[model samples]
Each structure stands twice: as structure tokens, then as C-alpha cells.
Target: MIDIKNVNKFYGQGDSSFHVLHDINLSISEGEFVSIMGQSGSGKSTLINIIGFLDDEFKGEYFYYNHPIHEYTRTQFSKLRNQNVGFVFQNFKLINTLTVADNVGLPLLYAGEKRKAIKEQVKDVLEAVGLPDASEKKPTNLSGGQQQRVSIARAIVTNPQFLIADEPTGALDSKTSREIMTLFKELNQKNKTTIIMVTHDEKVALQSERIIQILDGRILSDKKVNA
Candidate 1:
């Protein structure tokens, strides 16, 4: 469902250049759960951002569901991003002022959905994330794991074809991280959504059907494993 070819990302200018990603070539099929593992400065997050259309300024080619992603205009990419990609960051990235439901509903609202539809969607998503009763509460009131669950709900509420999680369990305890991984497995198994996760933990990396080990901004190995 996604392909990235010869992608190179460089920051700064001229001799002051710092390369974040180098000649990345990868393809993720539909219904595949792939994990990206690397140490700090291995460019894992840079690859994620490029894949999710969050950063398209780098040199290379990107195709989404067989269409050339670079061909789309910025406005078109914004719409496609909201519709096709769901991002769950390590920080949870919840709105400080909004209730859990409000934060989860933000995507649909930005997509121009009606208020009633947004509310219903938020409720359904919250329930799916096992937080049916917590929607009305503020994120600050929730624990770290709970906040991460809220982030997951917000990501999956739109039923995106691709779920991009960057160190999804980075902030959670072991038990909660396992729970979230289980949730991700369930989503991939039952719904057939494609999952691309970046994690450094060995256990978390094992949760994926495939592992792509990156080193020095290059693919060291890509292998399939049992989830």
C-alpha cells in the first residue's frame, strides 16, 4: 500500500548539512504489521514522517495505494492525510484544553463532518479504545496509559488504511504497553489495517509481523516474524 524509493532527507545547508535519512527504499503491503527498530539518530522517525506525508520536502518518491503522493497539491495532501493516514505519536499530542472526546473528534471536525456525526464517531471510537466512560474527562485527568489509549482512539476513529505509530509505547509502563500492542494486533488481524510502528524496545519490536532494522539511516535487515 506504500512505497518509498531512494529517499534522502537532509537538514541545514551546504557544509553545515546533517543527513537524517539516506537512500531509503521500502514497500509496505496492505494488511501488514511492520515494525521499524533503530537506536537514536537512526532516522526511524524521519522515515515515518516521510511515509505519512508529514514531511515531503526530502528527495525521493512516495506512492500511496498506487498513486504518486508527490503529485498531489498541498491542499490535496492535507485532505488525503486526514482521510488515509492516522498518526499516534509517542507524546500522545492531545489538546490541553479539549476533553477526550473533543480531541478525538478533531479530525472529523476538520474534515467538515457535522457536529452530531462527530460526537457519535467520537463515542464509538472511545468505546473501541476501551475508554467509553472517559470521553467527557480532560486528558490531564487521565493516566499516561489512558492518555495513550485516547491517542490510539483518535488515530483509528477515521478507519485509516495505514496506522503510523512512532514509539507508541514509549511513555507507558510494561503492562500498558503490552495492552496497547495487543490492541494494535487486534486492529490489524480483524480489520486488516496496515500498521507501521517505530519502536526501540525488543519486546515491542517483536509484536510486529515483520521487523525492519535500520542503522545509520539505512535498512540493515528486513525480516518476517510471527507476531
Candidate 2:
């Protein structure tokens, strides 16, 4: 569902320009689970940003389901991002002030969904993420793993075409990380949810169906993980 060709990214200008990505050519099919692995400053984040439609200041041809995302207008780009991609971050980016239901419903709210529908969708996602009773509780009261679950709940509430998970298990302990990975696998296999995750941990990356390793500003290797 995603195709990127000859993509390049740079920062600054002229003599001081810093290249962050180099001729990145990649394609991810619908419902595939892929992981990106790289060290700090290796440009993995930049590549995913381009894939997720969060960055457009690069030279590339990005085709999403045959649509030229690289050529979209800013408004169209924003709309595409809102409607197709869901994001889960290492920090769980939840609002401590809002109830779990409120947090999970933010995307739908922004999409102008009605209150009744948003509530039902939120409930369904929370249940899917194993947080069925967490709707009324504040995020601050939850454990780190639980908070991450809430974040996952929020991300999937929209039934987005795919998920962009950036270091989703970075903040958790080994056991918690395993649990989260299990949840991600279930989502991928059962719901047929596509996942593109960026993680430094080899164990984490190995859990996905395919792993792409980046070195410096280029792809070093792309291989399928052994089952």
C-alpha cells in the first residue's frame, strides 16, 4: 500500500547542507508488519516521517495505493495523514488531564464524528487494546504499560489504514515489552492491521515479519525475519 522511490532528504542549505536519507526505494504491502532498525542519526526516523506523511520537505516519489502522495497539496496531505495513519510513540503522548475515553476519541473528534459515535468507537478500541474498563480513568493513574495500551487504543480507534509505531516498547520493561509486542502481533494477524515500527531493539524488530536496517543515510539491508 506504500511505495517510495529514489527518496532523498536534506537539512540546511548550500555548503552546510546535511543529507539525512539517500535514494530510499521501498514498498510495503497492505497488512504487512515491518520494522525499521537504525542507530541514532541513521535517518530511520526521517524515512518513516516521509512514509507516514508527516514530512514533505524531501525529494521523492511517494505513492500510496497508487496515489501520488508526494504531489498532494498541504491540505490534502494533512487529510491523508489524518485518515490513513495512526501513530504510537515511546512516550505514550497522552493528555494526563483527559479521561482515557476522551484521549482515545480525539482523532474522531477532530474528524468531526458525532459524540455518540465517538463514544462507541472509543469503547471498542479500548476493549480491543485490553483496556475495556479504563475509559473513565485519567492516564496519569495508569501504569506505563497500561498507558501505552491507551496510546495504542487511541491510535487504532480510527481504524486507520496503518500504524506508525516509533519505539513503542522503549519505555517498558522486558516483560511489558513482550506483552505489547504480543498485542501488536494480534492486531496484525487478527485485524489485518498494517504496522510500520521503528525500534532499536533487535528482539523487537525480529518480532515483525520483515526488518529493514539503515546505516548512515541509506538502507543497509532488508530481510524477512525467520518465523
Summed backbone clashes in each candidate are 0, 0
TM-score of each: 0.97, 0.97
Worst 10 contiguous positions by lDDT, candidate 1: 65-74
Tens-digit lDDT string for candidate 1 (74-156): 88878988998899999999997999999998888888898786888898889888999998899999998899999999999
What does candidate 2's lDDT look like per residue over 52-92, in tens digits?
99998899899999999888888887888778999999999
What is each predicted model's overall lDDT from 0 to 1? Answer: 0.91, 0.94
Find the 10 residues in a row with the least total lDDT in model 2: 110-119
- For candidate 2, report its TM-score: 0.97
